[model samples]
Target: MNIEIVDIVNKINVILVEEFEVDEDVIEAGKNLKDTLDLDSLDYVDLVVIIESNFGVKLVESDFANVITFQDFYNLIERKILAKQQ
Candidate 1:
């Protein structure tokens, strides 16, 4: 169940575009995730749900405490995916 970062990126991009109605161009690694996506509290819930369903990685609220950038979010997902594999 090894997952590559590119796979994570592609899935995340698709999820953001389809589920969150985010513009693809704005979904950059360097951007601030919440601000770039215009996400509110409720949107975080939806994001959690989508991430769980898409990657089988259940993310808790505290997992986002240090997640400021989209790259940080991707790294979190990658770590969770690797943890799940273990």
Candidate 2:
């Protein structure tokens, strides 16, 4: 279970790392998505869309705004995926 979680987190990290040209090794769960990454509004939307597509979850703008860290983002995806299966 932990491994699966890490795998998804890595996928998210890969997107951030590639888009922002940041080192993936430095990205931590608690890191602020906007502050540390210096991401702008457009990037955030792109990220939200990518995450939704990645997890097969539909993300509302309000919901995406509330999500902060990478881990929080993963938790949202996890919940949505679980809900779909139930």
Candidate 3:
């Protein structure tokens, strides 16, 4: 499936808001996930599960090392989804 970045962002925002109890308004594309969302290691684990369950994309530790911002998260999911298609 060809997913748009905006859709990915929206889905991610919903997950964050519902799962993490994050405010929707704070979820911007450029914001850093750790700094902006105050996500810790456990939160990351939950996020990985959520992504895998929701998007059918498995993310490893290395995939998250460089993913600091929301856009990076979106790109990671987008890449994984596209890779799954191929």
The candidate 3 region of ten consecutive residues with least summed lDDT is 1-10
What's the best-to-worst order under lDDT? 1, 3, 2
Residue 84 lDDT in model 2? Answer: 68
Whole-model alpha-carbon lDDT for candidate 2:
0.74
TM-scores for the candidates: 0.97, 0.77, 0.94
TM-score of 3: 0.94
- lDDT measured at residue 46 in model 3 versus the true structure, 0 to 100: 90
Q: Is candidate 2 or candidate 3 better by TM-score?
A: 3
* Candidate number with the higher lDDT (2 or 3): 3
Clash pairs, model 2 backbone: none
C-alpha-based local distance difference test score of model 3: 0.90
Give the residue spans of candidate 3 off by over 4 A: none
* lDDT of the candidates, in the order given: 0.94, 0.74, 0.90
- How far does residue 38 in candidate 1 sit from its true spot (Å)? 0.5
In terms of lDDT, which candidate is stronger, 1 or 2? 1
Instruction: Give the C-alpha miss distance for residue 7 in model 2, angstroms.
Output: 2.0
